[model samples]
Target: MAAVETVRGLVELTRPVNVIAASVLTFIGSFVAGGVTAYPLQTGAAVAATGLAVGAGNAINDYFDREIDRINQPERAIPRGAVSPRGALVFSVVLFAMAVGFAVTLPVVAIAIAGINLLALVAYTEYFKGLPGLGNALVAYLVGSTFLFGAAAVGEVGPAVVLAVLAAIATLTREIVKDVEDLEGDLEEGLNTLPIAVGERRALVIATGLLAVGVAASPIPYLLGYFGAAYLVVVVPADAIMLYGVARSFDDPTAGQVQLKYGMFLAALAFIIGRGALEFGGV
Candidate 1:
């Protein structure tokens, strides 16, 4: 029983859901680039690298955040005494090493993206997370880069660029809202988050404005003839939900951020559907 609990704790630190979700984003990016079947090796490498990287990132983040987790996330693996900080660090390092092994097999551009992502993931929690808007921006860029990484693996990065931008914008908005939600804990940690620097309301306003740009530009893929009308069928509702989430951030940052994630997930689904339409029927 004790061994099982420890195993679960280790797995929890990896946040498997996020790992899988990010991997799917990579796969979607490859699919949009029409590389899924054509460049099977590269696509597989990109997807596998993304999953391992995300898992490593999450574990390392938890390690770095253990102290803060006591205040902000009491039930987290380390905070709950389920995993030691050193153990988490070691786990993350192993995963990062494996991710690198997979990444080196990809195209030059994909390899570069993976290298940058690996460095960024390692540096984010320690060097960047405390720097007011910079932390949020770093997280956003990392999220977006996954799309580009996938496309680069297939040798056609144009279609995935748009998806990357959209994902980044949405991620930025959600990160801000999350900062707002964690104001008290962040303050206690002496972290200079966006909400701490600009004030929660102002940070939320900025997030809203940024997301507006993303929402407005959501139609670019279909407009550029990369996707079809079916894309809008899914994206419109996603945009609406995201808009609502940002608006609601003013009242309930936690709820807003959670709802915003659902919107982002929907948007990713839209990307898959839209690209499928283009690839299968050109509809």
Candidate 2:
């Protein structure tokens, strides 16, 4: 049981939920780029590669953030002594290798994306994380690129770029909000996150501004005829939720974070459903 618990802790350290979410984005990208039946095997491979990459990235981030986690996330694997830093590093490297191996089986574009993402993940955790807006933007790009990687796997990017852009904007907003939430620990660790560099209030304003941009842009695909009414049905509500979150951030950054997180998920769902509806002649 002790060993099982340790294994579970190690898995949890990789943020499995986030990995799964990213994998879902990969599938959504494949579906949007070519439809559900297009390049099924390639889609599966992209999902696996994305999951591995995100999991590896999460582990490496935890390894680097062990000291900060000791204060901000005591229950984390490293902070709780469930995994050693060296062990986590090894785990991350192994996962990254597997991800790259999978990527190589796909097209050259996928391999290139995987390589770039791997380097970006390492750089973000090791160095860029200390820089305020730049770190957030890098993370946003990483998140958005998952869709592009999926499209690349299918040999075409198609309309998935719209989804990628939307995801990037929403993620950037959330990353900034998270920075605000972690301000105290970040300051203690001598990290100059946006909240610390520009003041919490300014950070909130910036986050809200980003969220507003995402909300405004959410309907672009439908208006451009890439999607349909079903897209509006779901995306409008998603936008409303994000807009509300942005408004609430002025008073409660924590609550705003929760709202944005849920809103982002809803927005992703909207993309999937909208695309499905169009493909199936639903709306």
Candidate 3:
């Protein structure tokens, strides 16, 4: 009981799991660029910056989206009274400040990426959320940028670019599915999300097509001699899972989106395994 109630107590607004995952992406980027071991300070700073930035983004998004969540996701921290909008905004600002501080310790390229991401996070809810497909694209880019930021922190940002593109496409799929899931609430709020603008079926179809493209290109890293056999082993199943999730989205959007995220996470793990094995195990 204590473990479930106390130890498991976590802040929903910050989306801690996603924060951690973004940090992993930063580390993976550095690793892929072959500078993670050599540039410890830069790698660590990049990871820290990515995590804090993701947290700040999530909190501020929730702060600005309180009204929408009150209808779409009443159980969310802001809508459920667990966290006030003002408090969330303040917390987001603090996190953003910390992220910037860490980012400033890195190279100029990483700092530039962080600055752009910070501005995007701040503007996403107010300026982009209502636009058809654009909001999803912005969020997708943010998710993928973690890898680029990490790679830039260490040195070259080439290898991670492919990973970023794949991640972005997968994230785009999930975002469209989520928009479809929230169609009713979004409609009530007069928000013109992708599903709202393109219609649910068409939106899901687009998302599926995007995911298919991503899956088809998932082997680019291996073919380019960036990763090894382990990557192929893991990515094959990950691609299958993502394909299924997108297909299922047409029927059960909520479940489909959740599954898509799980698959995406698995795909991310495959990248780490693929690269680590190639570098260390000679696999």
Candidate 4:
């Protein structure tokens, strides 16, 4: 039973849904941007490596923030005694090593990007969590790396690079809103999150502005003749709904599960759009 509990704890630590979402977004971007044809093996390895890295990063975060989790997330595996901190750290290290090893097999660009991501994850866990807007920016940047990784996987960097930029904008908006929703827990743990430092109302305003830009930009690929109408038709409503979620966040952050729900929605929509465009040769 003890061993089983430990396994379960590790599973929870991975946050499988989040891992899948990250991996899928990278997979979609790579497939759409011509990776499967150019470098299928490398692309598959990169995606697997990214998932491991993300999982490890999350575990490391929990390990480092054990004290804070004890307060803000007492029911979390480590804090609840389902997993030992030392054990978690070891697991995290192993995953990180695997991810790095896989990344090293790819192009030099992928290796460099993986190094940067590793560094950022460490910095975020070690010190940035207590910073203000800096923490938010770091999280957004890491999230943006998923789409960029796809581009790098195929040895092409222009189109996927643009998509990555757009992803960053959307991610930053959602991150700020999450800060608001988690404000209470973060404050109790003495985290200097944007919502705690600047207040919810102000954070909402900033998040709203960023989300507006992201939503409007969602149509740009179609307009630029890069993607077909599929992207436009699917993404417009998706972006609008996300924007609605952002607006609703102002009144009640908890009510705005859109931050989480719509991120996956957009990611799925992107995959569909990309596939549709490719199949029909419309774009």
The whole-model lDDT of each prediction reads 0.92, 0.88, 0.90, 0.78
- For candidate 4, write residues 1-283 as lDDT tens digits: 9999999999888778778877877776676677776788988988998899889988898999888788767998899999899999999999999998888887787778889998887778789977877887888788778777866877865666656767777777777887888877788777888888888899889988887787777766666655777776677667767777888888877666465367546745765575568557766
Candidate 3 residue lDDT tens string, 38-136? 999999999998988899899898888888888988888777666667878888899899999999998888889999999999999999999999999
Write the candidate numbers in order of decreasing lDDT: 1, 3, 2, 4
> Per-residue CA lDDT of candidate 1, range 192-218, in tens?
998899898899999999999999999
Q: Each prediction's Cα RMSD?
A: 0.8, 1.2, 2.6, 1.7
**Which 10-residue window in model 2 sums to the lowest lDDT?**
29-38
> Where does candidate 2 clash, by residue pair?
none
Clashes of each: 0, 0, 0, 0
Best-performing candidate as measured by TM-score: 1
Q: Is candidate 2 or candidate 4 better by lDDT?
A: 2
Candidate 2, residues 1-283, lDDT tens digits: the string is 7688679878997898899899999988888887448688888889999999999999999999999999999999888888889989999999999998888888888889889999999899789998989999999999999889988899988688888999999999988988888888899999999889989899888888887888888888887666778988999889888888867877787898889888888888998888888878857
TM-score of every model versus the real structure: 0.98, 0.97, 0.95, 0.94
Superior by TM-score: candidate 1 or candidate 3: 1
Which consecutive 10 residues in model 3 have the weakest lDDT in total? 1-10
Sort order, TM-score high to low = 1, 2, 3, 4
Model 3 ranges off by over 4 Å: 1-10
Name model 1 segments beyond 4 Å from true: none
Better of 1 and 4 by TM-score: 1
Range of the 10 consecutive residues with the lowest summed lDDT in candidate 1 = 1-10
